[model samples]
Target: MRKLNKKLFSILSIVMLLLLAACGGGNTTTESNSNTGEDGVLSAKFGVISYLTGAGAAYGEAITNGLKLAQQDINALGEVNIELVIEDSAGKADQALNAAQKIMSDDSITAIIGPTLSTEFFAVAPEVDLNGIPILGTSTTVDGIPEIGDYVFRNAVPESLAIPAAIEKAVERTGATKVAMIYGNDDALTKGGFEVMERTAKEMGLEITTIETYQEGQSDYNAQLTKIKNTNPDLILASALYNEGAVIMDQARKMGIEIPFVGGNGFNSPQAIEIAGDAANGLIVATPYFGESSDPKIVEFNEKYEKEFGKKPDQFAAQAYDALFIYADALKRAGSSDREAFRESLAETKDLEGILGKFSFDEVGDVIMDVTVLEIKDGKFIEFE
Candidate 1:
């Protein structure tokens, strides 16, 4: 009878211990269930959507490279451990929407970092905002982005600011009076850029001799280039992705259009020169980041990036790096990775010095930063000033 009682007691104790473990015992919780841990440290999860396998893959590669470096640096601080789940948008709107939907379904993701392009943001941001998830864009710079909702934000300076600066510099450098404009008609980014350039050209007292529109993936620009060449303008203003822009530059030079080309942020990559070769030698574009800055912060980042990636970082990499740090800083300031608290803290960001420059989000969620005029000389980007 004594042995039987002891065995029963032991079984009961085991059952109670199992129940307590199942119920978490008030101190242990799964990573997906809470942002706080037993040790009271922030372990937040984030999602990144970038075009890793399409025409915009160059930009996406740079963005993710920078993100990985930032993650390493931020995690090393020991106060915060950030884990990023990356999604490839493939430069497609539907792909971006699918990626964002997958991220929103996961309850653990505190914030999302991209959709890569302005057009992708237009497609995916509204739905993400409706789900109450915050998304910060690293390279999306077209107008009306942050206005999608309070949940959407971007670090890229808009075309409204960058385009005018580049155009003004082009006009000043070449004394260009008449200009020809070429743009991709099917995409929001290129279309918006074209509109900004048109208005800016008029404001700068430059005549638009001819305006030509091409489809996004059209390889043959002979018709458009021939028309633009007939105008014999002093310079050409282009709004296009690197692929199409490079083709345009190559075709323009092959057809004997030798005037200097002034472009927007889309042309801010070494791939342009890789494709256009000598045609891209004197290309002038305005961007928020100059990889060759004398600033110590910029120098350190560039050196590290080159050593790791075997190439110099571009504006996209710099912007994505800033975006991740901004998010992590907001997480620290809030002291909680809860969505509402994090969003509030992110909104209060002011005059934060980033790799690009000093940047802060305006009330509309657009980044306010200085645009630097850069001219591509000898296959490398150099400050125009």
Candidate 2:
């Protein structure tokens, strides 16, 4: 038993070390290519403005991996020479705006990939838009974010679509006639999902008996869940980020509430499973990509990703991968490096082949992705047929 404990300790230490290493140096590796074309023609620069450093760094790495793969393939064709200039949009609004300013100051970058989060995207949008540069959000799904700028487009499904399906899942499968809405009220992304969950649940005839909210970094969710328990709703619809989701799920399990738990897209994460332990076994959520997809394209991507990253890639990572390839497809279809033409070409995308469903951006710049209902069955994510 002592030897077993020691071995477990060693494994934990190694895992922690790996995580630290991954967190340390990220997205700092940029290609030092200094080649360029003639002055009159299109410059071969694509700006990747993303949260590639600090808190949202891992998210950026996933995106960077996808972008790098597409860039490599496109350049390998030898038909078009493209240089991806990656920039880190860290810190707050001011810092994000500064990054946009820097990207714009350099006239080389044809288009930008992301600011990652909706809040930061809003801050950077005006600057990038004023310069007539189009920004593609790889995974920022918050509703009403399209108002940030006309030049911004999203490759991920809007929160409105995914969150509603989750609500429907709860109402139909769990028989959740009365629900208590819980969410990270402080964040724009989380709040957007929460609002949709509320509206959709109401529309689907599920009574929202109570509403509970929490700010990020508040350790105890007991107070919020306490309110939820009082209402005695059939289930809780949590619009949560992965960080706080574990806490709520853990607390709910400890409270002895066997009524199933469901959450939004952000809850479809590995951390939620680790933190929720056995409680997460039955947890359900809505998402665009299923890590367990049996599709040939998904299998191919999964095999390649597992070989490179040494683990299964999450839906967030898939969004990043699909977004880059989608943009590349549009650029090739447009047949011109003209920035205006590229943006217009992106708008014309319809049912284009992609890793995450098809590329069909709606009028609001949100991708019309096929949202799937997923549940944690036996510690593994399985699609709800």
TM-score to true structure, per model: 0.85, 0.85
Over 65-167, each residue of candidate 2 has an lDDT whose tens digit, in order, gives 7777667656666656667877787736777787787777765566888777888887887778778887888777887666666777887778788877766
RMSD of each: 10.1, 9.9
Question: Candidate 1 on 1-385: residue-level lDDT in tens?
Answer: 9999999999999999999897776343234547776777787899899999976698899999999988988888878888899999999899999999877777888889998988888999999888888889988888889999998899987888898998898888788899999999898878888999999999888899999999978999999999999998999999997879999999998999989888887777778989998888778888888876687999999998899889888888888899998998889998888888888889888888777878888897888888899888787778896
TM-score of 1: 0.85
Model 1 weakest 10-residue run by lDDT: 25-34
Q: List the residue pairs that clash in candidate 1.
A: none
Candidate 1, residue 354: how far the Cα is off, in Å: 1.1
Q: Which residue pairs in model 2 clash with each other?
A: none
Runs off by more than 4 Å, candidate 2:
1-43, 77-81
> Among all windows of ten consecutive residues in candidate 2, which has the lowest summed lDDT?
34-43
